[model samples]
Target: MDEKVLLGHGSGGTMMRRIIDEVFFDAYGGEELAAGNDAADLPLPAEGERLAYSTDSFVVTPHFFPGGDIGHLAVCGTVNDVATSGAAPKYLSCGFILEEGFPMEDLKRICQSMADVAKEAGVRIVTGDTKVVNRGHGDGVYINTSGVGFIPAGRVLGGQYCKPGDKVLVSGTLGDHGITIMSCREELSFRADLKSDAAPLNHLIAEVLEAAPHTRCFRDPTRGGLASTLNELAEQSGVDMVVDEMNVPVKDAVRGACEMLGYDVFQVANEGKMVCVVPAEESELALEAMRANEYGTDAAIIGEVLPCPDDRSPRVSIRTGFGSMRILDMLVGEQLPRIC
Candidate 1:
């Protein structure tokens, strides 16, 4: 534990447990995790509900960033994904792929961050696996997380559930995560501040579900951003989506960076925000609930779903402020490779 570690630390025996107990549980120990069971066996609320699950891997470069790191990213990313399904995220499983020469101090810091994030989200890392690859073959670290949550009996949400006249809402400003990482990596200096929008969204989702059960679907625009996520939902639901470029929120600093780097904000990634589709009647309620939360203070309605242009194929279109419209599609290639 002095410095960097070797492959043996990931053998799933004493070394691994030592790492877990000494660095992880030792810092975040509480009654919920003291038992050291293979998996957590906690009871759920008495309400009849079905479960929602999601998993994701984080390989963000520079490990740490202005607002988050791979450890927090691993927990918050999966929690947001599960929450987007309109369910209450409850438990998590974390798997680590570490490099042989990775620093033990960094590992401990990461685990501590993970533990804190799990506590904040009210989700426990009940089970996990770890492995080590040769220094040259692997990146510094990679984390894969699986999450499970229970969707209450009357809750309904999905990409395919969208119908014409359904309104689209965004939780907050866009492209913060992508811009922050790029700035940190390229060492670019800017007059305005830019930080990653990385945080757990389950609490906001809970409020939305409570206020707007008519919401048809929820999507976190991660790797592909808002444009790609909308295209995905359009295709899945066989509907067309129309978004107003003026209505979508983007911070001035993030917008400046995107313009300078020739990066399309619509295709940039986000960690803390989400896109919600809801019946027109519930759009106001959803917006109010999202705006009341810290993560979504700038929430706004950006678009609506309509009948697909071609029978069953869904398409996404954007309306620019200049009085013209254009089709928006999935991103062709990576805007910023190695970006989480």
Candidate 2:
């Protein structure tokens, strides 16, 4: 590891994992922290009660984008993390670090956006804190959100729970959020309409869980995108994954943007999408449930888990559009920075 942290350490790829394992985890190792799920599952004070808790910070540049803004990202990110554990997100705490002299009007708008999203997700922002940093010491605004949710009885989910015969599914198209941010950041113009796919997925997740109670795992392909996310799940579950390229949805506009920018759609961020692993028999039910939600209309079964090969090393392989297979590894470095 390097003596100083680099942006790659936060890229949610190999470097990030190394830092977590060698630095943070080394210093703060524990059963809860070591589990390495999107959120921490904790035993509640009341018997038979369990809670999922997670925290996330947003530093997206521009703050405002096509379909959503930083405030929306902050609320949805934390809410999705808690909900990924099969919990119903209930409450959130927000903390803001504002640059001195920042415009008050923009701040108000951001807060209202957060309020609206929280209400939509059926979660409440019950607590928060505010801090002002020197004019040059901070971005326009940065938001940190911590959320807690109640887990249903006898419901268990995590990457490690995935089995060889489980099916893999994604809620909708990949890379919309990442490409939208890139185009906005670089001020690129395109004939095709481009927008961020940023939305809260708690409601959609609830529906899927209701229909596919045997869901083995749930993950939001955010920072490092679907490739890193699926790789993590495969390694954790000690299984292999074979994904079909044609089945992984990608909008024409997003594909065009990626081609123009040399971005790999599989490795781009998506704020409003999720990957669900469930028993093969229940895949149809899961897909049907997801499609019933607005956020998951393009839902599809993209892949299937396979037993590890002779070497017993977990791996992810994608069948390319050209009908060739290739291993998908984590991104070597950050492709787009300051992207939520």
- For model 1, residues 208-266, the per-residue Cα lDDT tens digits are 87898788889999899998999999888888999999999999999989999999899
Clashes of 2: 0
Measured against the true structure, the TM-scores of the candidates, in listed sequence, are 0.95, 0.86
In candidate 2, what are the lDDT values of residues 159-223, reduced to their tens digit? 89989989999999999999989988888886238888899999999999989989998999999
Which sections of candidate 1 miss by over 4 Å? 28-39, 42-47
The lowest-lDDT stretch of 10 consecutive residues in candidate 2 is: 23-32
Question: Candidate 1 local accuracy as lDDT?
Answer: 0.88
TM-score of structure candidate 2: 0.86
Q: What residue pairs clash in candidate 2, if any at all?
A: none
Task: Give the alpha-carbon lDDT of every model.
Answer: 0.88, 0.86
Clashing pairs in 1: none
User: Deviation in angstroms for 261 in model 1?
Assistant: 1.1
